[model samples]
Target: MASSSRSTLYENLKLVDTVAKVKTTVKELRRQKEISVDCEGNNLSREGTLDILIIGTVNRKVFLFDITKMGVSAFDAGLRDLLESGCDVMAKLMYDCRNDSDALMHLYDVKLAGVLDLQLVEIDSRRKSKQNHWFLKGLKKSIEVYDHDEKSERTKKNGTEQIEDAKRNGTTIWDKRPLSPDLKDYCAVDTVKLFSLLKVFRKKMEREKMLEASERYVDYFRSYETFPETKFYRHGFLPDEILRSNPRDPKVQYNDCQGCKKKFKRARLDLVNAGEKKRANFCSCCSRIITRIENQPIPSQSFA
Candidate 1:
């Protein structure tokens, strides 16, 4: 039986904080062939820290790990290896995986393999049908049919409210020690639903002959490098033609980073080439400083 505080869906869930537990969990999970994965981060930006990592097998065995609890070095080597490479598992499923993959790379300096984002599959299927619609949907809405538990009633009410509060405050709720039961339920549901959604999405992809496209889509995002947000493109706002028209002009103007006053040439042209126009001029140094601020942990405390 699940603890009364937890939903029945997570009654069998395990929390892995030790190297030994991670090793054993990976061994057992590999036997299941596939897993669904999700993560909670400090922020939505590219540099955000990955604070909570969740994995669930097809059979509903779920594991939650607080990566910060042990610090990165103390984090289970087995799990890190599994995420990076040399894992027997056949596939890892996720939904809209770009942010998660970026956070993982930012935190652990590793990338996930054998990943398939269900969102990509849905998009391909919709395109094939020539139906037009916004593709982003919350996991709860996307996989509501798979949830059969009465506990979800309470979770929907409490979890949604708590998550909204965290967003409103710009607080990292996942950084709170002694994780709250409501937050735990929210995290668990996020991961567990991925497995359920994967099963359904996989079949849909195969039927529509879009399995190949889905794989390619995931690979593209995995290798993608995101540019700075549009708001940061300041001094580099010149039209590409104008910039290129005088590539050899010795008299071309140079701009300094607003924050550091460091000189850079063709800042606007650089932004344009990156598919953005300048709203402000920031040197690479100032941009990294901003990224660090966005990725700061809650409580303003250092973990190690």
Candidate 2:
């Protein structure tokens, strides 16, 4: 579908608040090769409420499932099958699927799969362009950088302002019933533009021959066991696994820090010899701490 038509469809977003609507939406979704998804709630994670789930189709159709109202029935109505691994639906395009995956597994026992996280894709694009930073970008910033269409840009700006306004007013906006016009539009904009952004990044990754590496990064967070005890916690400051798997210089080696147990480039880590074939690696921070401890003055012997 054309981008303009898709935008129009998103503007006329469908609300699926009943079991019948969910079934119909799921049936339609199963026919698509890819779908864009986003979730909204108060602190959305394993322990938080999953109030809204927005799913957008490649054909431009968008459905805002009112998870707050339907609750467990939404899953019983086929939303579970649509989200879990090995479903007929090909890919669930999301910005960062980690927290969403965490919530789905712990709350609904749904292991989300076939995910193409555009956040990771964007990172891969930066790596290809030789951008040195690994900082994660939020959806609004990503839209600003990638989605150049006038309408989408306007939508992005308007939605961001609305969210900021709500924040300023000290409103728990997502928890409110009968979602405000701005809130609904915010949800729609978040899900709908993901399709276009995915298209842009997918093509770039394919041309760069990093499609496989991007896939690996996307799958890295799927395992529930890898999630942290705290809800919505990221595994590390840097995406070490992604850096290791898709290195700008493939010749560069990586090793695990004996102190923190996180991966880092070999050059960034110091080799610490504990004695007699007992050598360990430590990252700069860990190495510094170890040096400080080892250099502490020993107390003088006081025994007579």
Candidate 3:
């Protein structure tokens, strides 16, 4: 039961097309207390388009639901039910679970529960490692080690080349009617890697007695009500947060507006309160502060 052998045996290719197939898949998924789930798509949250949903069970079986071919109805309630039930009792494995969670929420209003995000586990482990050189490892690197470097150079090179080609195509391939083998392989490996990497990570966590901590982090990850905004789409304060905090707090500092390049000292706390609320680096006069800020950076302020 080596990770590499298990991955090779599963092959990551099981297409579920019919309602009966969906029901069967759900039945199988519900029976497992641990499973890995992944999705392939282009700007999933932004475009709300998905190519495939790969669900891998603890037994190394993967169900590849071709979203385009089968349509949302094929997997809709069954898929959501599996995930919803999984959240309560099953350990759902994923890498970067936040994005996947967001995509699921946007596309189908599915809220993923009971997720064990390997990436966060890796991060938590890295943070606790005594070695100074410890760093977060990506899924590919995690899989490479589990594979014991047995992958052929040509396969690795071809994967890299194909990935670059897909990047150049810029979401075009995501919309392609029939998935090419190369793309399918790429998508399949993602879910397969989750399964394989979890074995490696789980063992490490158990050995270090940090498995509980890793599981605890998943609850923390799930608590986020909304995804933090990036800089380009940054808006000042969220209306809800703005209404919750005091605008008159004197602790708020009015520094020169980074966006307006103004020295207007008379503006008072209007801009400072706004900036602090939005977690903006500069005043609201400038571009919407281009990053999400957790309240810990500021003193005595709670993230509203």
Best by TM-score: 2
Q: What local distance difference test score does each model get?
A: 0.57, 0.65, 0.54
For model 3, residues 140-211, the per-residue Cα lDDT tens digits are: 665665544444333445656865687787634565755565555556666666766776667566422233
Per-residue lDDT of 51 in model 1? 73
Off by over 4 Å in 2: 1-11, 87-89, 161-171, 207-238, 243-304
Using TM-score as the yardstick, the better of models 1 and 2 is 2
**Per-residue accuracy of model 2 over 181-226 as CA lDDT, tens digit each:** 6566678876778988877876666522343443454454545454
Better of 1 and 2 by lDDT: 2
**How does candidate 1 score on lDDT?**
0.57
Give me the overall lDDT of model 2.
0.65
lDDT for model 3, please: 0.54
Q: What's the distance in Å from true for residue 138, model 3?
A: 2.4
Model 1 C-alpha lDDT per residue in residues 1-304, reported as the tens digit of each score: 2122334776467777666666667777667666778888676334666777888777666787767675574244567666654223466777766567666665676666666666656555565688642233545666665444556656767977877898899776777787777767777776777766666666556532333433343333334454434433222221111111223356866665554443456463122223444455655535544444454212221101
| Count of clashing residue pairs in every prediction | 10, 0, 3
